[model samples]
Target chain A: MTDSITISIDGVEIPAETHHTILEAADKAGIYIPRLCAYPGLKPNGSCRVCTVLVNGRPQTACTTPVMKGMVIQNETPELKRLRSNLIEMLFVEGNHYCMFCEKSGNCELQGMAYRLGIKTPHFPYLEPKREIDATHPDVLIDHNRCIFCGRCIQASKTFDGKNVFQYIGRTRNKKVGVNADDGLGETDFAATDRAAQVCPVGAILKKRVGFKIPIGKRIYDRSPIGSEIEVQPKDAGSAQ
Target chain B: MANVATNGKRIVISPVTRVEGHGKVTILLDDDNKVTQARLHIVEFRGFERFVQGRPFWEIPVLVQRLCGICPVSHHLAAAKAMDRIVGGEKLTPTAEKIRRLMHYGQTLQSHALHFFHLVSPDLLFGFDADPEIRNVIGVARKFPELAVQGVMMRKYGQELIKATAGKKIHGTGAIPGGVNKNLSIEERDGFLKDLPQIVQWARSALKLAKEYTSEHLKELADFGTFESNHLCLVGPSGELDLYHGNLRAIDAGGKTIFDQVDYQNYIDYIAEEVKSWSYMKFPFIKSLGPENGWYRVGPLARINACTFIDTPEAEAARQEFKALTGGKPNAMTMAYHWARMIELLHAAEKIQTLLHDPDLQGTDLVVKGERRYETVGLVEAPRGTLFHHYEVNEHDQVTRCNLIVSTTNNNTPMNRAVEKVARDYLSGTTITEGLLNRVEVAIRAYDPCLSCATHAMGQMPLAVELRDRRGELLDRRAKGVDAR
Candidate 1:
């Protein structure tokens, strides 16, 4: 009778509204789903299926599917786990990570996800692809080698700043996120002060001047593993807070 | 690319170690087994200027610090100074200036500590002829455990000072255009006071060791990487040594001032960069002297040779002794670079103690807001030598052009020259011992060069983890969504 509906994710029940996606509801309930290319508060575009879950014996993206009353969702199935691990592996093999010497290793989400998943070594072979570094911009650096094509910078640039400084070039495997200018970042209107520079999930888009200011062991994820901040609570568990 | 001309066999020493990043020594040998030419090639390519174009000029102060891990604060403040002009100001708040100076001194201290204790000491203590595998900090620790500990502790203290003053140990984001974002707290200043005596004593002891090393190897040191070259530095109006801010000064091999207090913006009018066919790094020289004559040295030895006095008592005393030893003339002996580095370590410690007590250091006024300019140049004496950052901005504060000449590149010609001399003197076709080969590396390592800053890269990736049950059934998942955290 109430506007709020109950949904069963795995075996636990979570309360959510009709407009809420399974991801949004589960996040409020403190149950997590791994994701890439799904920035919070941005429009839910299922770009990376790291957030896949089973609904009624079928796989669905947790970021896109809306919650329905009495719906049963299995978020952690062996098959889904395998798919995510394989996807992470595919990404590793498709690019040159150079994790041994990367500046973003400790703070990198991709590297952290591998650790969280207990990936001893990438199941796939290393590709060691050579990528260009777009250092044309005076305040930002774009190392295409580290890019996973998440589109966070492109999305933030367009949605928040009303600036089309970044866009995707090419199609499918040939695709890459690029700046507006043809020559380099210097020719584009990419502002160093823009939110786009800070939204990079990897070391692809980085603000300059801060070179290893904080040593490796003292970094954010180094202090606490990623996702340790999210705590699941019942919808009505305001008393605990 | 043409496999180094002449009928000579190419001898390549890839990645001369004990320094940061990647570099190679290529010596072209003629049929007579004599060195024809030696090139210290910087292979890494980092196009920093090209990537910073679209970014707003103000953001560059924090961004360009990524250029080098060894002396990032130099780049941070240099960029901030360049932006200080864009913000249309010549003076920063007293507290901000003091804080920046403190950070610079700390950068110098930690860098010197790393170079002296961690990198060069091993070779000096154990001798270059020791087993190659064991000739490192590990070897130093095994040989002289107490001294090794002192070096590590001194470096750690300097790093903490950097963190307290700059807001982080390395690429601190505390500074902005026109001024800094924060001031050193009284407690923070007091924290360093407790360690002053120990740091000063350690600096003096290091200097003593350096003197001993120099005395023991007088004949070898005299011949090792010793040559005549012009020296460049930044000196105060009174001709005193100044690292944070100063006028450019160039001293010839005879210790005569070639140029005094020249405008940094017009560096191109005097200093010119030459690119060889083999290297990505350009050789910079005084434009008036031309490439052949202009190739000069900049760094500790050059700074010590060009300056009048240290201003601090202890370092000033050491300076006098060093002056007497070099005969009041420029010490072009590349081996003296270590001694000069030790002297600087003393000066940096002394400067930090003096700045810690300045009343204005804790003042609240840190920044000034103003109208923007189109172009400006920022200059600072980095731990290695002088660093220059130039920028041009459009109406919207977005960058239009950028040019950065780091300290190491300034010494490219000298480094190459040193390598050639060592290769010619020590290396031969019939008896190419590892020790002889190491001397070539030792020549390059003398500069404590940081090549990673000269080259650059970009990176990306994603993360996800799914927990499962038996029979491939789902249970739960923990994910740091690419954007979630």
Candidate 2:
């Protein structure tokens, strides 16, 4: 007989593997747990802390935590939601992320997560960090004020290109991403084709020279999340039926 | 001890550890100190260049950006430049140039920070004998929290700038052959200006820390110095220092200018490739002489040495301090690599400030729309060294030919020589420990070479390294899969 582990997510029973974390099992069973800096092709960085879920009453990142048997996961608990909203608030204020002027206005992961969590206004005051637009190279650009330090670009540089181009520099609140010796992109060994640019989930490490080619409502990857089979359901689905 | 004739034998290192991409290094050594043959191999293969043959010129930037994760900006820029040249388009508005320079500066900042902090710092800060398990930036974080924090902040600032200027961080559709799609708002510019003072302060502090560290570890750095080779870089029209756009020039270790105005098309004339049977990557040497005699180095150390003077006052001051430390023009001292990096950081910050303060930055005329036609080459000095992207397009704007000479390629000979020196110094006298080999690898990593971008879209194959006995029997083998990780 095959071994199976039972788990409960929001009072719903589900079968899971023995090695799975409560969060993983819940996610596998179609439970929604918000996240940033979590990509399928990369290691879990857990920097955003947006995917926090309550497991046996403690908050945990769903991306890194593995599944365990007989585990209980609470994805949309009141506390968890509040924590997620607060995290979103921190991201909005930590950088000058004015969505109206942002190139990633409708398509940004940060913006999407905040909207999904009902973040109408940033509770914290804007920590307007003065940043530079380094478009020295014809291709890549870096804007410090919008970066959330997810380390995705760094990971991409290290893993994808085998080039350690993008890196996290500085400490909390002052932390930023930059090239070797903080040079301009045009001056780095970084190629115009490096995947480091793709690793950035936000607008922090953007393509140089190229902006706003596709008009609003014409960009790709703009459809509903449901189209991908990873459906987003209402908060209280069980009671609706 | 008997002298064994190990001639005609091959030694291959697959999945060259401590390198950015899937590549191998093969060496053929004789009984004497002479290296009979050496080749840097690129094992992973994909037909990316071929695949791009028929794609729309406008789409080439996006497609080429996927060539390497670390240097997407280079490819994106090159592709855009090529397309612009082909279409015979008008120049980008002054505002666009400023914004583009700003974004490029961000990339340089983040990329260099990654190299100095995450990839090579382990070898510098901790003794080379430190366990590989703990010999990483993570370890640095635990030990030297302040430095690690500085690195993180520096990298974040650059990336954030990229995001704010472009739409997305990666594969952003910001620049086209004609021009940029969006213009920067006053609020965004003002917001960025406000944070400049803190960033400048942070850079200064980081520079101080680096200087102190280098002084404290002078002996360690001196011991780490490897082979000496000629330097080549790009300089502005007035023979002033230039990294973004300039003419190519070569300068020997004796401070003599060797070649000037080396055209991009004639690169093959000055640079020759040597292929080894064991390794897939080819070693490129200066064609001024033959492969056996020619050797060249590029990147930060090479660029700083090649330039006569820096433009910015802050960078000039840093350069003066660097010269004071080296007691002359810094030549092959590997420790100068750190000094060169600091100087570049200062220059990048100062340059960014200058670009931001330009009155024309707030203008709306950024992009100049046009169609595609002729062939063109885009060249720049990446932080690591000189980079060239040459493209030829037909009437339909389809790429007919695409030739790229990346910064890593420019440093090929020096890299091999550095490896040989490290192997001889560290491995010859001591026992063959993985740490010793890793140290040799670390010397190469100091350049922060990117092999994936050098041979992009060639194939999807694993990089393998094999250690062989005198008779070519495999002693040890290591391989990494072909995923874009």
Candidate 3:
């Protein structure tokens, strides 16, 4: 068996594997790191920049940058908080994200992250772009105006279904996600049977025909995060990799 | 064409590049012009069908939505539709149905837009040899800034609409089996309506530009030679073109309906899927026939030809324009696929506007709540073509069997045939050129097949497949390359 390495996160010394990142080690030790584009199943994109943490006095995305031996990582530094707050603010203003009317209100990752970071008022001005609602299919809707282009859906489409259905169309601020060539989801060779939809971290791509099946109180994830519902024994609590 | 004999050996194109999903092409030719064997192999498998076997039936839509990012809504709807069938539920409320149509239109608009502008446009507008470095939409942004911006804006509008209407964008939780999960607020409806005219204008201008480009390069596109094959798509009850909800129809090369008005539930009876040892992708064909004899095509080109008329005025006009260019109803010419896509875009925009104006959209009850019955199936036309999701559940409402047939699978037979024909035409007579191969690949990409959704669950890294000869020779290999372009 390989020997474990020790690292201090927020003053707690935790045993970690040699290849573990500061975020991974800290997460293993019951530390929470806010993230959006860092799903366990998909490759870490680190585009959201919400999981930034102080590693050796510098801020970096915990999902991408790996850990070093004897590293002093600060997940809750003032600088880190300000950076995270700024990132969240940018995300809010970059798209037409009105959370109050959103069905994913209490359960949304973006809203939850914002609340955790204590974003009382959006520092940036609202950028309400002229957007269209594609509700052609009986099950899903796609709203590009509110998209952050985190590429989670794209990754999900490509990685899981082996379909390169969702692709990054443009670049930089002009960047957006769409079905290849702006085809309706119905026209793409995508099946309703693949599992890519469950992994989307935002509300950019949605079910079309069945938008409000259950009341707010009966939502599956309304009471707890997906992680919270699954029990974690001490032996099975480490990195899922 | 090259007369090289196979000697009973297989000629394989591993990791068939540029097409959607992971697959390969294998061919076995006898000494004569008669082809002995051809297989379009789906090389990667993640067992998505098997994985969903024991999960809760209500979670089928959510789980299956993760199957393909491009067409999650199709899967979501298909799963929901299937569940609705099982539960013996009434149809969704008028408002909910309208909202559903609007969302479906959004996905169609954005997805078709992406196919034309991003995936296939680069090859057409820039020329195949323009520059590998500048072959993507990003390069188009630099070369033709206005068009690129329009494309981005159009895509953003579709995706944004999806997020707003569905609550979450990619894997939205809005759609349940009986109906939708949320209603469009008056403000939201107004917001969507305000943007309709601009989108319509943008779509029209884009279509004009695309036509101009096509006319300029007519020689190259025409010289590509149109292939003849059967076309399959869905048609609405009013004899108008439809994608979301419709019965299946297969039309022959001569523009005659071969198989008309088939029910979605009887899909398995008409269509059959055959798996090849060389590839993981399965070739779906007309049942009771051999691979070579059962070829069929779907998606924009196929859908346009399969339908008699489009409902929306702008789309109908666009369709006329497409017919003018193709010298008949657009059938097998891949170039016309772009035009067909634009027509769908116009229709999508118009449909969205129409839905937004409906007064019932402001109603509170988006869902028709009920208990679920055991087995169900959902059917919808994805951008690429027909999509179906069937689920069987136990008494506890857990899925016992989940079978999915996606659009790519529908096109598998025709796509493999197209690749072989292109390969023989472009590679046989002369030395193989990268440009020619690229064009061949572009021809396949025009359909925008989604193998991933047909094969696995979301988030698994695509495993590259390579093929070697009997002597252990490397014929072709696809490395895990980055999407740098």
Top model number, TM-score:
1
Q: What DockQ number belongs to candidate 2?
A: 0.07
TM-score of chain A of 1: 0.91
- The DockQ score of candidate 1 comes to 0.05
Using all chains and alpha carbons, the TM-scores for the candidates as numbered come to 0.74, 0.63, 0.65
Per-prediction DockQ: 0.05, 0.07, 0.11
Q: Write the per-residue lDDT of candidate 1 for residues B208-321, one digit (tens) a residue.
A: 899789878988899898889999988998888998988889989999888988888777788888888766777888988889898889889998999998899988898888
Q: What is the C-alpha lDDT of each candidate?
A: 0.77, 0.66, 0.68
Docking class of 2: incorrect
TM-score of 3: 0.65
User: Could you tell me which 10 consecutive residues in candidate 3 chain A have the lowest summed lDDT?
Assistant: A226-235
Give a tens-digit lDDT track for model 2, residues A87-133: 98998888878664355555677877777777899898888876655
lDDT at A3, model 1 = 72
Which portions of model 1 show Cα errors greater than 4 Å?
A: A1-5, A15-24, A27-51, A63-69, A76-241, B1-15, B22-38, B49-64, B128-134, B165-172, B178-191, B358-367, B394-400, B420-435, B451-485
Kindly report, for each predicted structure in the order presented, the TM-score of its chain A compared with the true chain A: 0.91, 0.85, 0.86
Model 2: per-residue Cα lDDT at residue B244: 66
Residue range B1-485, candidate 2, lDDT tens digits: 11112223323232444557756544434444333443455665555667566444666766677776665766666666556666555467787766667777777777777777777677677767777657778889999888788778878877777766555566565667766556667787787788777677766765665677777878767767455678888888666567666777887777677787776546666777777554344567778766776667888788777787789887777777776765665457665676677678768777778877887767788667565456777777777777777777655334667767778877776766666666556544212335545655666677778877666634444344333434444333334333312
Worst 10 residues of 1 chain B by lDDT: B459-468
lDDT of 3 by residue, A55-116 (tens): 77787788888767787878777878898889988888878776633445555677766776
